[model samples]
Target: MTTLPQISLAKLAATATRREERQRLQMACEEFGFFYLVEHGIPKEQITQAIEASRRFFALPQSIKERYGHAAQGMYPTIARGYSRLRGEILHPDAGPDPKEVFDLGIDSEGDRRPFAGSTRFPDDALAPGFARSLLALQTTVLDGVVPQLGTALADLIGMEEGWFPRHFSPPTLGQRVIRYPARGGTCAKHTDGGFFTLLLQEELPTRSLQVWFRERWMPVPSLPDSLVVNLGDMLQALSDDRFKSTPHQVAHSGESDRISLPFFIYPDIDACLTSCQGRHAFRVAEMMLRNFESVEAGNGAGRARELQ
Candidate 1:
């Protein structure tokens, strides 16, 4: 078993109060670009339930799954929007299409009218009982516990008050993606997340393989119980004046059973600016991601672009 680096939030938070820990976290972000966060406040049962719900939902028949598809943005079952590979297009010319199918959910807000906003399609009792509620409950709990902490930590990393981020993320556009990667014959090609940060809870270990970009190389990120993997997106990297990095990563083909992962993406305010604050680093990250998003949507996947809002 590979013993990956671990950061106990309780200890890190305790150390953060001492200024030295704060420096350590900032350095970690700069150097590793990804980290395994332990002792995060979310309970074990909640995580388990979320995974269980995801498995149940994905296990539904394909005909039933398509009923909830978001055709406009390519959001639907077995298809990934923005991050999933195009039909018949290999993520890596050398590799096959990513074997993952996905369903996405966003914050339920009335009259928000954002590009990604709307009521998510839920199966009725005929399809599955209590499915939507269970999934939403899990989403709420995970976001409620993780987002604020991540925001505050990020603010501190940039020399701002811990509460500074909430001002921008108030009623944030929270998005949830339920992904199912079939056996290792197909895998996600190399790509970066489109949101500011991604919190992934793995339902099972990687049957094929999972890898993350770090220190200018692709390193395997092992799946462990009770641990969530955190990765900085392009926006964070740009906002930090390149202090933090949004590294590129991919999932390799697995010949065993399929893999499932539930990822909750936290996006920044769409209209937020990308300039430096109080002599801190500039906020060009969001802008960079936007540009990358557009390019990707324009059929130029080979270009190094970031995620879209």
Candidate 2:
């Protein structure tokens, strides 16, 4: 096992209640770009069951999996359909094509009605017995453990009321992606997350390297068991006036074995606007990031770069 950084959520959560601790969390966010959350309240069994269900779904035949393809909403099973593919322009240009297949889900909010809106689908109960219920249970537990705490901490970091973020997220729209990477050599190209925050639950340790861009260099992030890797996104950076960095990252192609990962991306309300310390610009940075990400995925590298800049 590789050595990984340890962050005490208990300490961070406790600090969130106090002004000083809030400052520390904000400082860490600005400086490090990422953090490890430990002792989060999600149960171990729930994570395990979800992982098992995910494995079963991915093992299905490609034809069977195609039943869920949702290109219109960017949901369903697909390989590299949500981001750019151009060389030297896509986030991970140097790395080879990402040898992975993924199923993505978006949460349902007000004015939106869709099954598994803001969530992913497992094989139906008949296809994989107990899969749907077990996965939903895990999702609920994980969300209960992290969402409130994360929102509160973020609110505190911005010196806002504890419930400030919650107001904007009452009907939060989360994106969950279950990814399966083929055996070594198919690595994810370098790129930054397009949401406000990401919580990655790794089912199996990755044999390929995972690197994060920090201080203008790619630094490897070690994978640890039973821990979720959390990363900030561009919305946070915009809200913080670039104080909180949104680091670029990628997974290297592995040669030893295939890999699986479940990442839950937490996003704000669709219409929510991002402002700064003075609350001057009420622009919707989150939506913009999403738009740019989609453009890149559609092979509009030049357009995406312009929007990003």
lDDT of residue 6 for candidate 2: 54
- Model 1 spans > 4 angstroms off: 1-4, 12-21, 72-96, 204-208, 253-255, 278-299, 302-309
lDDT scores in order:
0.62, 0.61
Global lDDT of model 1: 0.62
Q: How well does candidate 2 score on lDDT at residue 138?
A: 63
Each candidate structure's count of clashing pairs: 6, 15
Instruction: Show model 2 residue runs off by greater than 4 Å.
Output: 1-5, 15-24, 71-97, 108-122, 204-208, 279-281, 301-309
Model 2 RMSD in Å is: 4.7
Cα RMSDs, all models? 4.5, 4.7
Judge candidate 1 at residue 87 and give its lDDT.
39
Which residue window of length 10 is worst by lDDT in model 2? 79-88
Q: Which residue pairs collide, candidate 1?
A: 78-101, 184-254, 194-307, 208-254, 238-285, 274-283
- Per-residue C-alpha lDDT of model 1 across residues 106-152, encoded as one tens digit per residue: 77655545445546656765666556676688777776777777667
